[model samples]
Target chain A: MLIFEPHIHMFSRITDDYERLALAGVRGVLEPAFWLGQNRTSVGTFVDYFETLIGWERHRAQQFGIHHFCTMGLNPREANDDRVNKDVLAILPRYCEKDSCVGVGEIGLDDQTKTEEKFMAEQLELAKRHDLPVLVHTPHRDKKKGFERCIAIVKEQNFPMQKLLLDHGNEETIKITRDLGCWSGFSIYPNTKMDPARMVAIVLEYGVERFVINSAADWGVSDPMMVPRTVVKLEQAGVPRSKIEQLVWKNPIGFFAQSGRISEQMLQQPARANLRETFDGNSVLRGQDPDRV
Target chain B: MSRMHEQLATLLGPAAAGADAEFAKVLADRSHLPVVFPGLPRRLGRNHLGGGRTRVGDATIDLDAFRPCDLAAADLLIRCEASDDELFDLYQHGDIEERTMLLRALHVLPVGPITVRMFGEAQRTNMLVHVEAALCDGDLFARTVGQPGFEPDVANRVLLKLAFLDLPLARCLFAERHANPGLSTMLQDLATEREAAGRAVWRDTWRMIGLAPTAGSAARLVGGLEHGDDGVRAAAAEGLLALGRKDLFAFAEERLPREPRADIRAILQRCLA
Candidate 1:
């Protein structure tokens, strides 16, 4: 069964473990530009970060035979900084057109402040101006307010709710996002966020429509393998093979492939035996034994 | 109202008029505003986990909601009410420091009867607090450390350096500690000891011993430790010993009391040791 993890931060992951993920039936990942381990100091940083999200990371993932795409925006964590936010908002237009960039996103509120609401409105406007989708970051704390504010801002901006993918959603937030007709993403984190068992419950409760799962792996204590692990959990929980494929595969393909970054045609390309060489020049597979047919 | 105030009032409303004038006053006079009723008294926070709302005039604001902000252009800014304790929690947790300080200042600003006709005293306090609080912890730390009347600044700098170890700027100041020969010598010795320790992470570093050239590899690595070649048996024993595989300790003690080969025997004996 093909699985798509629609919101993992692969840039925060420092490993060739994407190869392990690829072997486990994960076909694609959509990373969003987030605050690094620390907040950045300038707007020029957002431009460079956007470039890397859609640039270096795409090539890095291709080496493992997995497709990589990204959504770019000023994260809610960084939006708290007025100086950096001002600069990032100014530079966002220039970066929106990059090749593998999917949409303006993972932007919303952390504490649900007026500042966050202001920036969220501006970014939603940018997304509308560029005719792009948005990935909304619902705060881990004060989630109700975050969810409400996200919907309110989208409404205020008159941005279509369908173009928004509200991420880090819990059961409560997911219901609202779904009711608003926006896509809902659950970040399958280790302990503090949605775990595999919880995701199964969400699927059982919500069904799989307009739902996506992301690893949301970052500099914090999180696992990149969580996507495949969740897929396996769904399998063990007696989830249908087709439903699994839809939530983990078809839905993400429908969402991210719209960026015109990675297409079905590109996915149809033969799985290169020499993926490392075909993507990056370095060969990470030099001494490894191949599968014996 | 100032000319700029009158201009903005025509654009937005009477609401936006005196904001610029209040901001200018704050810039001209480097003084802090006073605390008002909306603020949680500094002592009230001793037991509370701090998830409460305070009203700034009619606007209800939460304390924890105060995060970092952009204070470069304070004219158009509207500061939210927040407490110092609440702001400190966010700052310590990596919320931008400048904004937290701004929130702290907002919480402590003195409430006065002289309210600008357009905006109340609380609103004025919020605006100015946001501006002044824009200085981050690093900036504040440097200022406090360098301020005159603080003894020599060296001892305090070292203490501040330790307190801010997690922050990158603190590390730079720590590097400058080398200019002092006394502190420099102690730090150098500490560095040398840390280096000589080899810094080998012990926990999982040995997990791959099964894959390495070891006796354990003969069994577990190649899946033939129980019934492999003689060389494999010997390797498994050596690997088991290296891995500190307690499960195999009894077997090693009885089955292969000691390798007849002096080299192998010494290796196994040392593992037990």
Candidate 2:
């Protein structure tokens, strides 16, 4: 009955009230590193953010007994800045560890800018380098071009399609990307992104394999509880419990836990409060031992 | 009297007018040209093509202008001398490009008799099919609507309309719409407000795309750099550069000296540069 939120930005949100989500049955989460509000300017800025993802954020979630994981990348907007872009890209390799790090993600396209295209190519290289799964960001505008370009560049680089998770996928983009054999994701926002109702429709149409949903809630009006709400919605819609489990739990664990960041044994360990835990030491709930959490 | 002749004279500059489809066939026969699908859409201008086209100063030619040739699997490629519009015609006719700019220009051409080749991941092989221009546009357009931030109405109004107009005229029209004494200043304030409110990424893009040129936008951008978060600082740098304020270069430079993060320092350098 433990479900995982494969994508969310817990730090971007004030999830003080998310303990209710635990009561509802969410057991783990994977927060892909993404642009917070606008874009991050410096490598140091990204480092701090990345640290929070692997550190404090993970700890914060554990207070309620939820396991936390994250993926890192040079987001599209930040990729536009050549100065910080290279620096960030350079650091991505180091952080994309199988332990603690889940995959290379939230990288793809934004604005469909030439700069974005260039960075997209480079980040794909980084993904290949780390042998980690890639989380791509399809641009909000000119999505056809962005999606087309994303496919084109990946094919050009000869990266394995199975390792790519094209995030922000909607009906059209998901169909195409999934057809191309890349994992697909839909972000559930209140209005701007996908909703649980629509997510059900997509799963019904696309048949749920290589498909997942996320909150992507960060620095905006987002629902941290949306993940479990989606599970509830799926149940109400007549989707089989097995199917729901695969989408919310097994799939994410397969993709992320394979990175060697977390093992079945590690994930099952009970939560413990420790003295050294801080935003710097651990991101989960304060004083929780990550080994047990 | 042939379409090739008529199109060639205009596209390839009168000198290429006499070239016929036989020449295209000959070239296709001799070169290791990839197969071209002729059923894709073309562009709206002289470079109008089905797939892609090649340009000759003042004139463009279609791949059909050359003689068709036989080729091997590895030699599978398509080359066309055509306008953007005409090349789109070739694409609609079932042509594809494996070479750079071999098919240039064609964007909005109607689908005709020829079939186009599409590569499918499932088969991992090229599949030939005929798709009409309108259908291609519709397909791509529909897919775009599902993307994160595509607003066809807004994109059409802003990018499409402005495509034909000069920058100055576009700016004037922008000014007239707001009806404020300090239209530039007002727009800048609006952009700042939007950014501060934690607006969705798409909303911010549409609002700021036009106003990035205003002095007010630049001022706010400069002011935004000092905000607490790195995301804000990065966005401010981007906005300042978009505003074309060279003066901000010095300001950016000054901050870089004190910046502790390697990535932030790099962004500041690019902005200043």
Which 10 consecutive residues of model 2 chain A have the lowest summed lDDT? A273-282
Cα lDDT of model 1 by residue, B1-273, tens digit: 143323323332332334444445444542221211111121112122234444333223333433212111111223322234433332222111223333333322322211111112112222222222321222222222333333333433343222122122222222222223333333333333544885312111112243233332323422323422444445545556655656556555554453455554555565566
RMSD of each: 23.8, 24.7
What 10-residue stretch in candidate 2 chain B is worst by lDDT? B114-123
lDDT of each: 0.55, 0.55
As a TM-score, model 2 comes out at 0.48
Off by over 4 Å in 1: A260-262, A270-293, B1-273
Per model, state how many residue pairs clash.
12, 98
Candidate 1, position B41, lDDT:
21
Proportion of native contacts kept per candidate: 0.00, 0.00
Top candidate by TM-score: 1
Interface RMSD (Å) of model 1? 23.4
